[model samples]
Target: MELLFIERISTEQLEDLHRISVHTFRSNYGHLNTPENLQQHINQHLSKERLKTELEHPEMRFFFAWVDGKVVGYSKLNTGQGQTEDYGEDQLEIERIYVLEEYQGNGYGGALIQHAEQQAKTLGKSNIWLGVWEKNPRAIAFYEHIGFRKIGTHTFQVGQDPQTDWVMRLSL
Candidate 1:
């Protein structure tokens, strides 16, 4: 419980982010997606090259949580603009947030969410939001515990299946 040290991802940590993202995806979604599909999804969206490119983007923010110099998790943030946007005047969307399974029961997810809120606040955002898979009851409960309330629903593709997600929001 080292307070899950969190910070904005730096250029030097792109590879680490990619590595942790793959691990997170595998452990968290292996049951929901086939190996080949998971690999394809993660490789396309969470690869090192994609992280590097996004980190260099002007409108997105990425944060990482580390312990003993090893990244355990990360959350991606973005400014609201188009289609899938948050509801704040300066909305900061939690594009993604993850914690390794082994670290999940130790409050790391809470730390990450709090860190993301602070980061959003730092950017002048008054609210933060994210989408959680509808069937992920544990995740939905955790988000509610952290003060996020479901405001809407959206559909996502999970492998060859369609999935439901609840749009959750929190005031910063």
Candidate 2:
């Protein structure tokens, strides 16, 4: 495997962001969801326009992981008010950390989490948190392995379907 490198993504890379976001989401969850629901979720949340707006947020940062010049994963980090939930000023959110299915186990996701932690620490944050689908045991286990503890639950929408997400936090 080629060594992976991480770079901050700029607005000029909106197309790449959109493509990877949608593709990774679909690859990860499409089989478990109805096609209609998957399409609706992608159209609503992962559109290029929405991504561009998100990229412009002052408190949100995006990063892409590349291996041998190919983009294989991405992460979104939010601080201050850009966080999906109000976890206070000392807390940062790992809003999204996704790797392409083919790239799993390559350490990109773990690297992204480490990056998030470093960002939070540099910003004087004491904690980093994220919501993982309750049904995703793999993600939950990964978080646990990384020292995250379940703190609460939140409601997340996948198209029109209501789902539960476990909020996990790691104190830095």
Candidate 3:
């Protein structure tokens, strides 16, 4: 198998991030959400304009995972005020990490997590954290297997549906 490559996302790659963000999101959650709700969520969060704004934000960073020159996954990390929750200045949040369905079960996800940790270390963060949807046992297990511990739970909104997310953290 070709090794997956990780790179920091550039402004020119915003549209690619948008595309993979939507594709991976829908592929993973479309079945559980109403079509209208899913579309609404996508439009609100993954639209090109919104992603551009996010990409321009100084405290947030985005990266892409590539295989044979094609984007196969992506991740978003937040620090300072960009963090979704107030976890302090020494913490970095893994706000988003998704691998395309075809790449699931491969090591891309782990590679992304390792990338996030390295980013955190570079930023002088002592801990890395993220909120995984409670219903996503697979993701939760992956995090746990990677040394993250469930510290708490929070509510996340996907259109009209309110979902619970397990707040997991790893001390570096």
**lDDT (C-alpha, whole model) for all candidates:** 0.80, 0.93, 0.92
lDDT, model 3, position 83? 95
Instruction: Report residue 31 deviation for candidate 3 (angstroms).
Output: 0.5
lDDT of 1 by residue, 59-159 (tens): 77778888877677888888855214546457788878998877778877888888878878888988788889998999999999879999898876655
Q: Which stretches of candidate 1 lie above 4 Å from their native place?
A: 81-89
Give the poorly placed runs of model 2, Cα more than 4 Å off.
Answer: none
lDDT of 2 by residue, 1-172 (tens): 5787889899999999999999999998998888988899898889998899999999999999999899989999999989999999999999899999889997788988988898899999999999999999999999999999999999988888888999999999
Clash totals for all models, in order? 0, 0, 0
Ranking by TM-score: 3, 2, 1
Q: State the local distance difference test value for candidate 1.
A: 0.80
Candidate 3 off by > 4 Å? none
> For every model shown, what is its TM-score relative to the native structure?
0.88, 0.97, 0.97
